[model samples]
Target: MERVAQTGSTNADLLARLAGGEHVGEGHWLVADRQTAGRGRLGRGWNDGQGNFMGSTVVHLTAGDPSPATLALVAGVALAKAVTAMAPGLDARLKWPNDLLVDGAKCAGILMERTGNAVVIGIGVNLVAAPELPDRPTAALAAKGAVLDRDRFAEALAIAMVDILWTWRQEGVDSIVRAWLPQGHPVGTPLRVSEQGIDGSFDGLAPDGALRLRRADGEVMLIHAGDVELRRPVEGN
Candidate 1:
């Protein structure tokens, strides 16, 4: 694997270069010490400083392709595995879609961009503790005792991701779901999920991957996709 490490924004620059006809292929990555215009899920902005693991990998898919959701899961799973391997005693878990959490704190987040038959996976992990966001309960890796070497971690992640991707491709979604279950957060407990317009509330993670929450009128609603904020049980809170 090869890496292009720079001092500035990686995601923005990669997209720019890619638009300019630079054909980046698999096994190559565009890494940045700081992403001035870093992005996150749900169109949130990230203010990544130096001393963080912020980068993106370019993965090329075959011309005829399936949905890219599996790749996203594989990337998250591979990253969780690598982080656990790098830091023993780190009980890393996967928050569905693409977040790696250790001891209930976020250690990594992945963003995938698809163009035609290729996908560029952008991963941002905080090696050092990040500043607090009053609006959410998100977290960083250093808060979970995971301070890693960027280059080494990136290499391990890429290789492991390739393996995970291969397995998911061969065995299909069931295999991926089975592997994801053990690491999943406990079910039947209230999970704080984003409400359509107002603040979200506690619910449980459904078996088929939707977030199950009771509405104001005692109706149970299944959320397809949105950010989730795992909260402590009312007694615990």
Candidate 2:
């Protein structure tokens, strides 16, 4: 673990280091107290307030391991576990693809980038405060009465990620899927997926980690990529 007062983006910095032939071995982490150009999936800006958890880890794919894409599930499960452990009795759910939700609001997000045999997984969690997001609700651990510092949270997250990634390499994607499902919303929860222009109930996750969307016409669509939003239940349904 390497801690810095600030950085442009942990993922970008680590990628630059890798490009320059730096040996960022697996389980190595880079954490920043502040990020000026942090990013999320689909080119969205990730806001990182001071004292929040802004860190990245290096993962090297081994033989017989799943695709690099499946790292998203690995990250989500590790984050969910870490946060729940920090804030006991809180409902920490894994939003499909790679977001952590607390009480239906996003509290953290994961971003993964691949370079050759290495994958840099960046994670940002709102520990001290939540930024104002225009499209969706957001929350912070402090707001939920959990008093944890960035270093403490980062330490826990790093340990959880290391343990889970080992499982992914040893047991395969089925083991990860089994562990993630219980931390996520139940099957059949209504969802609105923006990428495919489909609004359907959550079917489940496919064997390869693609999202399963059960449409109204009884068609089960396997979506490889998309933005997922939990739908509000209709009154008196």
Candidate 3:
């Protein structure tokens, strides 16, 4: 793997380098020590401290393969497995598409961008605790009593990604779906789906990864894509 290590923001540097024709080949790693311009899902700015982990890897998929959820699934399964191995007692749960959480708080998030058959999978995991984060709830591995050095820990994570991605390529998304279902967001449980125009939609997880919303009129709607933040079912609904 070709590793490009940066002392500051990795993503912004990556975008600049990518824009400048720096060949980001498959299996290349871009790591950051402190991300001044770190980004979370939905273009939100996320900053990481010196000790936390933030990185991106490039993956090449076969041409015309339109598994829209591919990078998210790989990131989800790989991150969950890595955290599980690191702290045996800390059970990891997956939020559909691209989040890994522990005890109802986000521990890691994946942001993917695609260019033809190449995908850039950006990942952020807090190796230590962070404070005053936006969103409903968030967490770091250290906050949950797990700690790891940014580099060695990232190597293990990359290895896990290799195996999972191989399985995904050989088999299908079902490979991950089957593995993730049992580790999935609670089916039939309530969620808050957030989007620009359509927010505040209460929902649950459908079998095919669609968000199922239960509205005020007692109607259930299927949402194909949106930001799903977990929430409790309102009382007396």
Best by lDDT: 2
Question: Relative to the true structure, how large is the alpha-carbon lDDT of every model?
Answer: 0.67, 0.90, 0.72
Question: Predictions ranked by TM-score, top down?
Answer: 2, 3, 1
Tell me which residue pairs clash in candidate 2: none
User: Largest TM-score belongs to which candidate?
Assistant: 2
TM-score of each model, paired residue for residue: 0.80, 0.96, 0.83
Model 2, 1-237: lDDT tens per residue? 999998899999999999899999888899999999999989999986998999999998777788889999999999999998888878889989899988998999999999888899999999888888888899988898888877888889999998999999888898999999999988998899876667898888999888898999999988888898888778894
Q: Could you give the C-alpha RMSD of every candidate to the true structure, in order shown?
A: 3.5, 1.6, 3.3
List model 1 lDDT by residue over 1-237, tens digit each: 444445455666666667788998766777776666788887766658567778777767764443565666667777777777788777777776677776776667888777666677888887775646666455666666667787787777778777777766677655666666666565543456554442334354444445466656667777766676665555653
For candidate 1, give the lDDT: 0.67
RMSD to native, candidate 2? 1.6
- lDDT (10s digit) by residue, model 3, range 74-98: 6788888887877878867888768
